[model samples]
Target: MKDSWRRLAERLGGRLAFQAPLRELTSFRVGGPARMLARPEDVGELQELLASARRERLPFIMLGGGSNLLFDDAGFDGLVIKLGAGFAGLEGAGSLVRAGAAAASADLLAWTVARDLGGLEGLAGLPGTVGGAVAGNAGAGPEGLGRAVTRLFVLEGDGRARSIPAADLNFAYRRLEGLPERAVILEAEFALTSRPAVEIRARLAEIRERRGGQPLGGRSAGCVFKNPPSISAGRLIDECGFKGQRVGGARVSEVHANFILAENGATASDILALIDRVRQGVLARRGLALELELKVLGPGGEVRA
Candidate 1:
């Protein structure tokens, strides 16, 4: 396997590593190392890397800003591909904005606001890249990134590149459905509205202020669970007296119950255990199962509990 990986790295020209540490790459700061890590410069490089991985029969997964992900302590045993600086392009033409999947959500939001694009102000303080946000349908309240997206460019699992229109996309609460297996989003175009720059900045400021109460200073993966229909997940957890609750180095944020903060020396297992405890508590007391908004991944990129 190491020989295969070495050959693959040589074929792709460089920017590859063996047993790369993943804890610092994520917001939670608790993951282990990935067996192989690849940083692809552009779409062409990404496609080549993907095809090579397929031919080599090596598992692969994409890593964006690593904001809402939880990698297991054992780490991923496959190729972890992260987009490089070449994929972070952002530009706007009229009310239509084009952004690379690697572009930061905050950067995209700022670009839109500078051009008086009103729709993306809601993404002002959101972490992660534009692709991750769109993939997860990230939002504040009922509004989401999908609503602003008009088109998407993706490299599908079978090494085919295609553009999908918003009309054909299926976006749900906290998730985008119907994407082809192993597809990677390369770029997205958003249809925004023309608004005054002052108004856009004010709206952005308001949204940022609203998120101020979240435990921003701590190491957290933002919200831990998705809000149940008509109810806030944070409120539910707070009602269950889970604020400041701790399990090992992981603790529920007192500022916001939905956030689970990781202290120094926290392990991915600690976070997972705390998540299970909270889920069981919420289920036992409220009779409602809190669904996770945070994505948890095992060593093989499989979803973990």
Candidate 2:
């Protein structure tokens, strides 16, 4: 199956590599490598690759900005599909904005703001691609991308494109429940209200202010644990005295307890160990079972529990 992807990549002119090091692919910067990695430039190429992988029964996982994700030290055995420049396009009219999957979240936010579009300003400091944000329903506070999104352009395993209404894409806290596990998001359209430029700028500034004290820039996947019930995971962890805790090179950020920062030299094992330690601590001391918010990819690009 690995060789199959390589051969297809050669034929399709898609970027392909064997044993591609993924340490630099993620924000965490603590992964090993991927057995196979393919970056498709366009929807046609992505569909072709997906079709081929499906025919060969080869598992694959979509990788966007590499934010909010962690890869294991052993590396992924399946193909890691990434969208390229062809999917980074952005176009909009009046109060509607259309963006490609590869478009950066920050760029999208800025583009809309420049046009006096109001909807996604809450994502000002978020680090991820449009596709990832939509897939995970990313947000700051109560505002999520799902609220602004009106439509989605997706491709199925059969290489067929479909336009789905946002209402059909039932979104919840950090989850897009209506989307199937195998469906690939190619582009999304957002419906926003026309607002004054000053208002947009003010909202962006407010978000920036609220982001204070959090390690917005770091070698870490945003938040480690999700907010439980009514309280935040950071507050709980801080109350448990886990702030500034270290496990090898991975340490809980003093500024934000939910974030675990990686230093000059850190291993995937170190991050995993730290996460386990925190979970154990919270469960034993606080009687709270922490749930992971960030996605952790196993050796085969499989979801790690």
Candidate 3:
């Protein structure tokens, strides 16, 4: 059956739409078309869209800047809701920075450093939006976005908005396990200490310099494998001799094996194959099963195992 969404979206006059390409929204620049992609101009419009989707019993997924995601070549087959400029502003008070979920995480870091707010210097170069970072507890060792987040405003499954403490939210290594699927992160407030602006900026710069040795940029879903306890994923992949391994246009990054780099025109299937190859090699050599750090969005709204 044809979905009733297009007609409804058209009636809204560009507030939402259908069959949007996932490649452009994702950092990997791969994947196929989403069944529907809605850009709500405001919270009211978003609420309206959600209400409609719920009434129709249609599936929907919220997306930010789409970093840290590995979309299948076959893409998603459900509504992909993205909040744009209407939800991407930031404000601050003494030791607090409140940001809209859609606000770019990089912008938040820059703003914090400019204001002499300390504690997130280690996340200087991480890409994607604040909401995704908060959801994933994004960070390097000893510090993550969750640590700074004091409060989060979430639109829960029942369509009620609730304010919650970060500690109350379920956040673990690269995943928020217990949040209801229908919940849409609206905004968050983070705590930071006042510091010398110059010092904070310098520390951010140092992080950037340190991360320079790793492969970033190009079409990638960031780190492909989660670090196992007491060891790094990159080091293990390198040890398995899978660096520079290629299948079609997807290859394990020679610079950092844990990261898979897609040459132009690569498909998500290619990357998936490479991921399997890396895992097999690592498992065979070390008898350890490596878990994924990136979320893989698959076709027909099917959950990827």
Candidate 4:
């Protein structure tokens, strides 16, 4: 299987590396490695690569900026494809901003805000790539990234390109419900309100202030669990006295109960174990089982508990 993949990688590009360490790529910095890592130069290349993988019955996963991801220490056994160069631009005019999926969310938001756009202020202080944000429908307060999406250009699971309008999608909490699973977002167009640049900056400043307690610069996936309908996950964890809890090199952030920090030598197992403990504690004490917002990918493409 390794030999077969090596030959295919050669046809695609040599930049594809084997046994690539994923720890440094993630905000958590605790994953082991990817068996075969591939970066597509453009959408065409990505399409061809996917077609080949499907033909070979080789499973492949899309990896964005790796901010909201957690991989097992045993490492992924399938191909990992990361979009590059071609998917790294943000451009539009008037009240519409089009951003490539691989574009950094912060850069894209900053670009729109600088141009006096108002709708994206809700996502100003979040991390990860535009694709990751869109896939997860990440948001703050009552606003989600899906609300501003006007259209999406994506590569469907069967390697067909599609242009879908936001009205056709189900914009729910932390998910784009109607979109097909494994659809690769190439670019997205966001509808924004035209406002004074000063006003947008002020709103962004307010958001930053609100996220001040998030342990922004730490090596941890931001906000580990999704907020339940009744109360916030952080508040529940804090109420359960889960803050400052440490399991090996992983520690629940004292500043924010939802964040689990990974020290230099921390393993993915440590983080996974800590997450289970938090969930168990929350369920046992509050009778409420919190769902995870973060994507936990295991070795065989399964989800870890």
The residue-by-residue lDDT of candidate 2 on 189-305, one tens digit each, is 999999999998988899889888689777988988888897899999999999999988999999999999998788888999999999999999989999888899888667865
Give lDDT per model, in order: 0.88, 0.87, 0.81, 0.86
Query: In candidate 3, what are the lDDT values of residues 30-56, reduced to their tens digit?
Result: 888887788876777777778777887
Q: Give the TM-score of candidate 2.
A: 0.96
Clashing pairs for predicted structure model 3, backbone only: none
Candidate 4: where are CA atoms >4 Å away? Answer: 1-4
The CA lDDT at 96 in model 2 is: 92
| Order of candidate numbers by lDDT, starting with the best | 1, 2, 4, 3
Q: Number of clashing residue pairs in every model?
A: 0, 0, 0, 0
Full candidate order by TM-score, most accurate first: 1, 2, 4, 3
Of 2 and 3, the candidate ahead on lDDT is 2
In candidate 1, position 185 carries an lDDT of: 91
Could you tell me the lDDT of residue 48 within candidate 4?
A: 75
TM-score of each: 0.96, 0.96, 0.94, 0.96
Report the C-alpha lDDT of model 4 over 1-305, residue by residue, as the tens digit: 55656676787667588888888788998887888788887877787777767877777788888988999998888778888867989998888889999998999888987787888887888888899899888877745888999999999978999999998887777867777777888999999999999888888898889899799888998888988998989999999999999889999999999999998788989998999999999999999988988899989787643
Error of 1 at 129 (Å): 0.5
Question: Where is the poorest 10-residue window by lDDT in model 2?
Answer: 1-10
- Candidate 1 vs candidate 4: the TM-score winner is 1
- Error (Å) of candidate 3 at residue 220 is 0.7
